[model samples]
Target: EAEVAQSPRYKITEKSQAVAFWCDPISGHATLYWYRQILGQGPELLVQFQDESVVDDSQLPKDRFSAERLKGVDSTLKIQPAELGDSAMYLCASAGALNTEAFFGQGTRLTVV
Candidate 1:
């Protein structure tokens, strides 16, 4: 079965430090997403990837956040100089290459001090 894969179920970093999260989307999928969920809020789409190409990243805070799907498959999200306000759940989701069912992985909860 297809499943989204995420690592380091949790992360703690001091303010102004850098951190990165990794994800491996279900094989054969071509659409990937990176979402950030604030406490109690719905997940906000941060970036969307269609294969190795970025289709949407308008909501992504470009100043500090960066993501890439180098091989058009697995992906990575990085935050430079993480901020206390950057603390949140980073969720990786994937849909079919043609936009079908999407699945979420247990996220990486970031805590910035």
Candidate 2:
């Protein structure tokens, strides 16, 4: 079965440090999404990409975070000068189309001290 792939299953960093995460979506998927999930809350969409272009990033904190799908396949998300409040699970998911079901990776958990 096809699945989304994420690296650095866990990460730990001091407040104000920089961190990044990677994700490789299932083959042929046209839509990819990056989400931040707090332990007690539902996941929030940070950014959405269709092919190599960003379709929506209204919720993404432009001053501190960024996401990219350079080749329209694998993608990366970065947080510069991470803060304590940024500790959460970063999830990556992909779907072949808007109405199709998406497959998610075992999220990258970030802990900021």
Winner by lDDT: 2
Give TM-scores for every candidate, taking all chains together and pairing residue i with residue i. Answer: 0.96, 0.98
Backbone collision count in every prediction? 0, 0
The prediction achieving the highest TM-score against the true structure is 2
> Candidate 1, which ten residues in sequence have the lowest lDDT sum?
94-103
Model 2 is weakest, by summed lDDT over 10 consecutive residues, at 1-10
lDDT of each: 0.94, 0.96
The TM-score, computed over Cα atoms with residue i paired to residue i, of candidate 2 is 0.98
The parts of candidate 2 lying over 4 Å away from their true place are none
* Model 1 ranges off by over 4 Å: none
lDDT of 2: 0.96
Q: Can you write out model 2's per-residue Cα lDDT over 21-68, one digit (the tens) per residue?
A: 999999999999999999999999999999999999999999999999
